[model samples]
Target chain A: MHYTVKTAGDQSIIIYFGEQISKQTSQTVQKLSNIIESSGIIGVEEVILGYTTILIHYAPTRISFHTLINTIKAIIMDVDLAKTDERNTIEIPVLYGEELGPDLANVARLNNLSEQEVIKLHTEPDYTVYFLGFSPGFPFLGGLDERIATPRLENPRKKVQAGSVGIANHQTGIYPVTSPGGWQIIGHTPIPLFNPSDDNPFLLSPGDIITFKPITKIEYDEIINSQI
Target chain B: MIHIFNVIKPGLLTTVQDLGRKGYQKYGLSVSGAVDYYAHRIANILVGNQDNAATLEVTMIGPTLKVLETRKIAITGADLTPYVNNSPVPLWRSFTVSEGDILSFQGYRSGCRAYIAVAGGLDVEETLGSKSTDLISEIGGHHGRRLIKGDTITANAVHTNKICLSRRLSTELIPTYTKHVRVRIILGPQDDAFTAKGIETFLSSEYTVTKDSNRMGCRLEGPTIEHKNGADILSEGMFMGAIQVPQNGQPILFLSGRPSVGGYTKIGGVITVDLPKVAQLKPNDRVSIEKVTLDEAHELLYKQENIFKLLQASIGEGGGL
Candidate 1:
């Protein structure tokens, strides 16, 4: 559990667990995040977990940067990476092919597989939520089946609608909001990934497990219409 | 009762802002707030409002607001040359406007943005515990967007104290904006990713703020920082004042509206004390970064906070007007 801490400014410090992204690395990052969060250190505002880093934003007036660093260092020294917490598993219903996923055929063509095979491969493995980024509630997922791994579109779309599930290279994620992006679209999810009015705005968090369940177009319509 | 102001002209990018939403960045929510926090605080202080009271953050151009009710207000930050009923009003001071009085600006004068704080703050529905607008996500502020013509904004009911109306910030306390601004910064979470020469280029180079700059970030067109390895890193949480260098080598200085996380390598982050100066800078302004230790950054912040305390004390003594 080797790590390095660097000062972002007077009030924030970024703790890098490892250089690259891996489940093992992310687990350590999440554990440290959980510990620091529950520590109740005064002036500690928020602990934001990334793929392999934890950014701690604090109030310098309440706690000195040096003192906060010492407290974090002491906490990290005693942390056991093997300690795991119960995480929530979320099932997302996605509609594949045709208008729902305009680039599904292209993905199948690029991977030299039928549309059914691509869909089967995408759903087989349970992907891990690396972190939420790019847009609100948008998850950056890992553990995409390499067999269906395809490059992103050379030119990104001007606007990608919310609930559009996409893949870029070896990663797969759902677009929680409508934003201009470069990922290759594969399907559309009926569930709202983000709702500002809800008690919990995001459906997923770091260290959560996500499994995409394929559904027919009529089922997607039924889900969408039922929500309204 | 709704104390409202009708918008005659909404300026370029007028939006309601406060101290910003907190404890929600982990959900990928941005902590959108007033960019010029120093000015924002002063404006609120002048009108005897709480520090986090919502105010209108006016950009280069100023909005034309028609008073629907008599209200006490204060203007701070950029000198947009605001006038009430065709008569000019002073900056960094509190004043009262009567019913039917129209407030408008002449044009851009000094800084890039200004803060207009009413006595009770702009009464807008708070989203995620903040009145500040997240322009990217379109979630908060006045309908989660910028002010436009025909928009009517309400001010919360406040009992005005005549004594506070005489308040004015001392001349020395008001900040001045210039084309060439020197900002202090503390080097990196990923400074090692760059070569010594790259670090030198970043510190020594004079970067001009590009038009592409916005609340999200200030894109600088200057010397290309040579990366020791590739510029991309695994996406990590980003903070305000982060100097992120993309693959093209151009540096983008993240501000209040920056995303929760990013993948580009950041060389360093600007000290909190100097962010107001960065906020006041307009496009085409020349900015030079000065490297300072984290201790110095903390000391500077402490000094600024002390000055604020002094200002509050002086007002209590009835010295300022």
Candidate 2:
């Protein structure tokens, strides 16, 4: 689960492992990232955690490349990444069907189930936040039942509005910001996952758990109007 | 006092930009900033400003700005036939712009973008340590979007050192956007995955920058470089200059605000030194690729650092405006 720091440039160092994305790899990345951030290394500006790698950006004028490599290596060697635990569960109220969940019928048909069954299955269990990426605050949540596994749309829509709930591959996530996405849109959340104007911009972070609670469209409207 | 410009005519894609908001890439936010950093830096330096100071990033067609106060200003990159109060203003040099002076620029005579920087720099709140606009995130810069007509921008009068117009740029540094460019590239970590012919095709191909090119990526049209292992490689971290070959085999030269990572397999990455050439490329502009060793890439980067060091030594400490 450990690797050497690869040289990205005069200002960046990337720690790489296997090139695949998985929960175990992501947890290791999240653990390492937390250690680096809390350790308070000088000249280190930011640590960008990915599926299987971490990009550490530093101010070259303050810390030389050699010093940075040594500092990262020293920190990595002593840190025991296995002991990290305790996941926090976060409840998300999702308004499914009709105007909000436009694809609810499509998803139910794809899974060969009734619309009510689809909602029951979706809201049944908690999902782990494997990683956080894709348009600020968008979390790649794992632990979706294989029965509901769906592929992305063949031709992605030009634009998917923010707060749209989606499922692609074995994962489900809400689009934090309005951008083009290929995931199968199942529902929408009234909660703002990312708000730059707010003190806390992102709603979800890595290692946090999430569970959907079906809500009425009237409730969705209420939450949206009052969020500002 | 730095003269504020009331934009009378807004161009296609005029926005406030700086070096960009770094360290936000982890959240999948693109490092949105000036599409042409070299020109932006030059304009800042000419105006006695910091490298990351906010300035107007003007696209092909430039805007007509009315000076609201007296200030020092300079424009670089594209030749737009700029004028101040109906009198022609020289490019790549600073000039004192008086209050009520009407400053304007026309369509591009050469290059695709231009940088207009003021003495003290644009006064804007820094989000995540930068004034650069991220239109997608809608976070930084002037309300995080393109500049519009009738919009007045505040300027910070922070210039301590002034640059004399007599300090003209030498021929070596004066950018010539007219010349056909050969962008140097470093081989990728997955370079061996591609066949030798595939690699050769990428390096030798003379590609034309498609009109659809933007700050995101420059879609090159010419040779379709087919990959040996196909485009099924895992989505990995991407840099500013990474040349990714899509399913169709056309190489997309990613630029400033490309996604942090995607599923495409990158064949090679353009050297940082040659990025200025890539930045200046306009639609239909031809560009050739040349492969270089990692050492060569490091050497070019070192050379740039040395030049900055030399400038700092000559200008003295804390010389920025």
Candidate 3:
């Protein structure tokens, strides 16, 4: 398959390799990301990577839209997406169930599995970080066991507390901040996934593989109060 | 010295805002800032402040502020019947307010959101290179929350006895609120999803901004746009003025604080210059949509840039309120 680029807004361009989400599509998207970042294209402020698309934001005053698109297209065509190098595996600790996880029972009941079985299934597989979006430091993690797949709450909670781990469809993520959310909360992570005070705020980045390690509430609090 | 005051009565949702927070969106962070970015930029320029300077973004209902100190200030965006010390303050005109003067804003007579820019700008902790408040993440601005009663905002260190530009812009240059509004738009990546008739209806139909509108998006109540194929597409990147049609068929125009992306089908996007028209649209305000080519959009932005150049040349560059 080939890639296509389209104008998003006055100052942004959306580049896509495929229409659907797949491993190959993600690879293509990552390849595009690598090319843009390493291409040293001036005026390109940031390139947002997604499931199958990459949003390139540029400073309109500094660079024209045509020049940016052409520069990026040239870089994309020259880069080989098959070269996946330096993928990091990260282990994230989660305090599942009890007061930390308000919807753990609900998710397990919907999947016809006990709470313990749900935990075992959730932590058993290593998930890939598709991309970061929705809120600051919120990761769209893939590779969840389909049996534990659950739909978001019909009526979204007015507020989903920060660090609340949740599952939706085949993807699972953690809420970095309190906002109105519909995701089914299954657990909570005590670690500060996003802190503005720190130089490198986000704990995970795209192309990084993540595995969940079950921890107790005491461990959660200890980690939260302490440094990462 | 610059002064920052508190909200004696926060009319609706008033918060600190700047240009935006970029680079952080990839980490799922929202680019939350002024709902009307054009207005935010113009206000910053009018006050001789940096484009990313933090200012007070007042929603539909304006707030009552207690002036903490004497400072130069300018109010732009919406006409909210603003008064300081029981006297009407000129809109788009830089002026000084003495300490202990009560700056109160009543109901908005015109637009949905208004911006108040101080001469030296508001002093706030910057996060990720911006002071923009992302309410969803609770990370920026004055503790990442709406301005409440008795909140003391610190101002930057710079004081001037007189503003750089003492002249006020002509009424012809300033936008006026009316019942009829026409916004220019560019057709979208998802225009194929809607039937031709659906597109026509969207263009011709008269839509009214709902009362439920906010900084996130302006919900338009109008003719239901039906799609030819009922397919659920994955969420994608969305920007300010992007008109998204959900399953319910109602059109929602994304604003400044909208999510970085969405999954809904977007039929078109409002032109960058015309977004101020969308910004000024209030509840019950009827708006008409007009389609324009990409070339036209570029020309419009260019024209706006020329106007800024002219304004700066005529108005002096010393300092602005």
Candidate 4:
């Protein structure tokens, strides 16, 4: 856990763990973010993880800048990097094709594979959640099969429904809330990654593992109806 | 006393806002709040509310409301020609309105937004420890959207407050809303991504705020800022005041509703002291970007934090208005 504290703005400071976006850098950033978040240190408002950095927003009046830097430095040393990595694997149930996934057929055609082959390749790997960004609770997942890689839509959709699982190039992800995107949607999941009303608003965190489980439309409807 | 006001007509875009939502940016949720934080603070101070209290943020146009029983209310930032029962009330000061008195705004005066602060904050449900409205996400504040006709606002009156009601801000402290502003910035966490010539072009060129600009960001049109490589980078954390230059060379100055992370290279970030000026800028406003140091930005911020405290002391003790 060695890092550098760089200038962000007047109200915040950034901790750069490494220069590149690697799993080691991500783990280090996540560890510090978690420590600062749980520290309950007055004046520290937020702790967000980037590829290899942590942007900490602190209130000047509550805690002075000089003191905040000192607090962070002390906390950074407390992060035991040698400890066993903590991982939480969440299974997201997805229903492939039909109205929910309009781009599924297009993706299969582009990849030169049948729709069944595309689904099989997609559901195989255990994707790693690098971070949550772009939109609320939208996970930036890594680890997609190269054979099923597809290009994004040239003209972005005006409205992509929530829970839509999309593939863009080598990246595959799920949209937690309804937002306009250009990803090549292949399927949709009924599980909500973001529920603002709940005490824990986001379902996934950095370093978490996720696997897509193929489910029928009836199962999706049952899960959706049960939640409601 | 619970003072309530019924909305007769909502303005172009009026919504309840406070300081902003914090701690949720990690989840990619926006930190929506008052754009002009300085003005928001002044209005709150005049009405004896906390700086973080929820106030109605009136945009380009203004709102019309029928006042019921209420405590002293203050209108600050962007004059907007606010009136009480056809009588024009001055901005930057607190005033009392009687029951059945109609409060409305006429004309687009100076500045782009205004804040209305009640003696006690508007009673709104808190989401993620904030009362601000996030229109994009549709969460928090008066159903998480702009105020519509027939909507009602209720504030729990704080009767035991000691601050005088007839207080007014001195002329020297009021921020001048200008069409052209030169904002100071601190060169960035990703400035290395840009070439030397690109950095030079950014500092020398004058930019105009485009129409596409909104609460999320101010999209500027200016000379192309050359980059050493491509414009895209590994997505990183972003905050308000971050000046991100996309492939087209133009910059986007992020505002209150900025995303938590972005993939573009950020050349610099506006200083804390100048963000209020950026917030008040209207579309097509011309701007000049200047560079400042980290130490200088911090110094200005520490000085600004004392403005409200100094204003509070200048007001007289409690009295019958």
- Candidates' DockQ values? 0.77, 0.41, 0.60, 0.69
Candidate 4 lDDT, B206-321, residue by residue in tens:
99989888889989998899988978977778888989998989999999988899888888888888999999888888999889887787778877777767766654454321
| Model 3: residues with Cα > 4 Å off, grouped in runs | A38-40, A225-228, B159-165, B313-321
**Residue A66, candidate 2: alpha-carbon lDDT:** 74
Where model 4 places Cα greater than 4 Å from the true spot, the runs are A1-4, A61-67, A70-74, B1-3, B160-164, B312-316, B319-321
For model 2, the stretches where C-alpha displacement exceeds 4 angstroms are A1-13, A37-45, A58-71, B1-3, B159-167, B312-321
Task: Say which prediction, candidate 2 or candidate 3, comes out ahead on TM-score.
Answer: 3
Top lDDT model: 1
Poorest lDDT segment (10 consecutive residues) of candidate 3 chain B:
B312-321
Order of the predicted models by TM-score, top scorer first: 1, 4, 3, 2
Top model number, DockQ? 1
lDDT minimum window of 10 residues, candidate 3 chain A: A4-13
TM-score of 1: 0.98
User: By lDDT, is 2 or 3 better?
Assistant: 3
Q: Give me the TM-scores of chain B across the candidates.
A: 0.96, 0.93, 0.93, 0.95
- Candidate 4 structure quality by residue, lDDT tens digits, A132-202: 88888888877899998888899999999999999998789998889899999989999998887999989
Predicted candidate 2 versus true structure: per-residue lDDT over B1-321, tens digit per residue: 244888899888889999887766766677888888778887777776777889999888889898897777889888877888768888877678878888887446888888999877898888877898888888788888888887888899754455333233445677788747788887774565677888888888898888899888888988877678787655445677778887788888888867766667677788777777888888889999888875677677777767655543443233332
iRMS, model 4 (angstroms) = 1.4
Clash statistics: count for each candidate = 0, 1, 4, 0
On DockQ, the stronger of 3 and 4 is: 4
Compose the digit string of candidate 2's lDDT tens values, residues A80-114. Answer: 86787777889999988787667788788898999
Task: Assess the local accuracy of residue B99 in candidate 4 as a C-alpha lDDT between 0 and 100.
Answer: 78
**Chain A alone, model 4, TM-score?**
0.90
